[model samples]
Target: MLRRQARERREFLYRKSLEDKRNAIQDKKDKLKRALDENKIIPTELRKDALYLQSQLEFDDKGAEGVTTYIDDEYKWVGVDDPKIMVTTSHDPSSKLKQFAKEMKLMFPNSQRLNRGNHEMKALIAACRANDVTDFIVLHEHRGQPDGMIISHLPYGPTAYFNLSNVVMRHDIPEVGTMSEAYPHLIFHNFSSRLGGRVKTILKSLFPVPKEDSKRVVTFANQDDFVSFRHHVYKKPDRKTVELTEVGPRFELKLYEIKLGTLDQADSADTEWRLHPYMNTAKKRKFL
Candidate 1:
């Protein structure tokens, strides 16, 4: 009887010892898992298998079908990687458009003024091709107002024509200062879909984007050389031709160019050029 009791006691202790060891190992595993999770020590690529970084993305599919926004996808206009532009104005010597073209060339990084304006479009395009000019911006003036513009990208074209309003000039600025020859960084604002994404396509002719990673210092203030462009377009639906009454929706484009530097900076007095005040107020203010 004594032997039997001793054997039973020994068996019970052996089972208890095994259970304790298993419990210790499981606790260790739990602690290790918690540590790995907290430290983010896992490689991101490896974590992708577990869909770790997926929370940073957005999915915008399944939108309503019939809602029409006149906007388009990102606009694309491919031109020479190294842009070479020929700038010109109307043939009229007295045309203010010529002066506008001169100042505009300064805004572009690498561009030149044509020796003379060519009235013939086909001949002008041929001349540009011969000169290896990738694109051109032609300023058109009517009477005295600088009212029209034409931009053509070489080879294949999404050539664009525009009618400008509230056009302002350097001379118009009451207190304009001499500008450094720094190539101005350009800012394009408020050109929506109805503009056929022409702003970007047109700008690409001036500032071509690189194929690889592009790092740019677009963060300069008005003191630094930078240019801003604003454009607005209004289109009305066709009414009965006899009635001649117009009906449609309209939109606004707001563009402002301020000297790039902070107000306290001595060099920040950029030529004060802006759209006419009447152009802005007259649209909203009911006629007196």
Candidate 2:
């Protein structure tokens, strides 16, 4: 009799808990309905229509979808190998973009080559994720413009670049003294001819004008010079604070010239300059 009574008591508690949950959910639904009804009762047709003499506001038609909160799948593209350089001819790219791609292809000739297609890209991305591949190169062709700008979108939305190091470096590079001082004139060129509107938009958003302007230009140089420059940018400083070090007198170096482009293709000239005096002012160790 005691065991049977205990079972009944447990069953009663379980039913009561479920009933409580149902009541709470119903209460929330009722509250939402009430608020919705309150909003609905206000008739827009009854509102006064007044024409006040306000200053004319000009709005640019640049397409902007209001802030979106996107949901993404759990899978990530982390272990992909470094992207290989692939190339295709484009009439749309600027001269700079074509030249850059040609150079990259020479360096990585065997990298996979494929035509540009959204479906193909999506499939490739899925394959890359499944195969633990984080890096691969796609050479897209444009009319006469260089594809450099198209490269920007490879790390967008659901296709987020899992590599934070590049992101951080890209963010921090312009702030370093050399690039920082001349930063005002830095105009980022879509050196690759395959730029798409989506890629262009993403780049513009990240390095917004009158703010984080990317003015650095990529010039072709001997492999040695390129290697040296990369080392300077990526290298870690040796010592933090050493006693009586034979250090050269500190003078900020503006490593690169900065420039800007106008909307018109004809007047799109690079002609801006600035100098950073704080390039290497920090005595802190590179690692630190």
Candidate 3:
């Protein structure tokens, strides 16, 4: 099993490298095609290969124009299969953290919470893989306050690390009602940038498709790089009016890092992106 996993990882990395090359070429082709269509000068860098690209463009069809990337492979089964998520807390978790993990489990349909009682990270991840878990989430806390989250996609990964803040669990909400178990509709706001799109894809894949009439809704609204999470259920009184009720367990997440490999490979895996809070313009720039 170990050998097979290692071989598969190598193959995945090889395909990802090829995908990068294809994306670069596709970008150049798009630029050349645009310049020609607008009757403008071809870019100096593309001039030498303009004829070659133009000839290749003739074979391009709308159906085959979309270039597939490694990301597509990672989430190929997203819509087809309801994701199987395994949620766990850090070792020796506090009672509050455990409660938070339980709330998280309830948030994602088809998810289960596991007690991380003295279990190693590698063993936990191995068990998840063997059980065909689609994603592994580890919740962390600082002095009993849930403060961090790590989301790792299985088989292979592009793990994302997030800092949690202002968490309000279910029981904490006044007069909170029973939680809905139906798959919830998702709302993503202000995820416009390239990195924002990548983050959106990771977060979006966590939920299964909801029915049109599903009353439950989950929202991730981004502003100045902090993503605020909200859960709600709505009811329509009159044809023109709708009433919304807030479900419990709302929080804010700030993405701080993303890795190209799973948690176990963190030591050697390439870092895709990381927050640089010490930069001169960090306070002025908004990533998402």
Per-residue lDDT for 153-176 in model 1, tens only?
Answer: 553233444455566666664444
TM-score for candidate 1, residues paired by index: 0.44
Off by over 4 Å in 3: 279-284
Ranking by lDDT: 3, 1, 2
The C-alpha lDDT values of all candidates are 0.46, 0.29, 0.91
Best-matching candidate per lDDT: 3
Tens digit of lDDT per residue, candidate 2, span 16-131? 45766756654544444444568753223322311110111122123745422211111122112333323333334455444545444433323343343334444554454344
Judged by lDDT against the true structure, how good is candidate 3?
0.91
Clashes of 2: 34
lDDT score for candidate 1 against the true structure: 0.46
lDDT (10s digit) by residue, model 3, range 191-253: 998889999999999999999989999999998788999999888999999888887799999
The reply for model 2, stretches above 4 Å from the true place, is 1-75, 80-85, 92-97, 103-148, 151-232, 241-288
* TM-score-based ranking: 3, 1, 2
Provide the lDDT at 167 for model 2.
11
lDDT of 3 at 203: 97
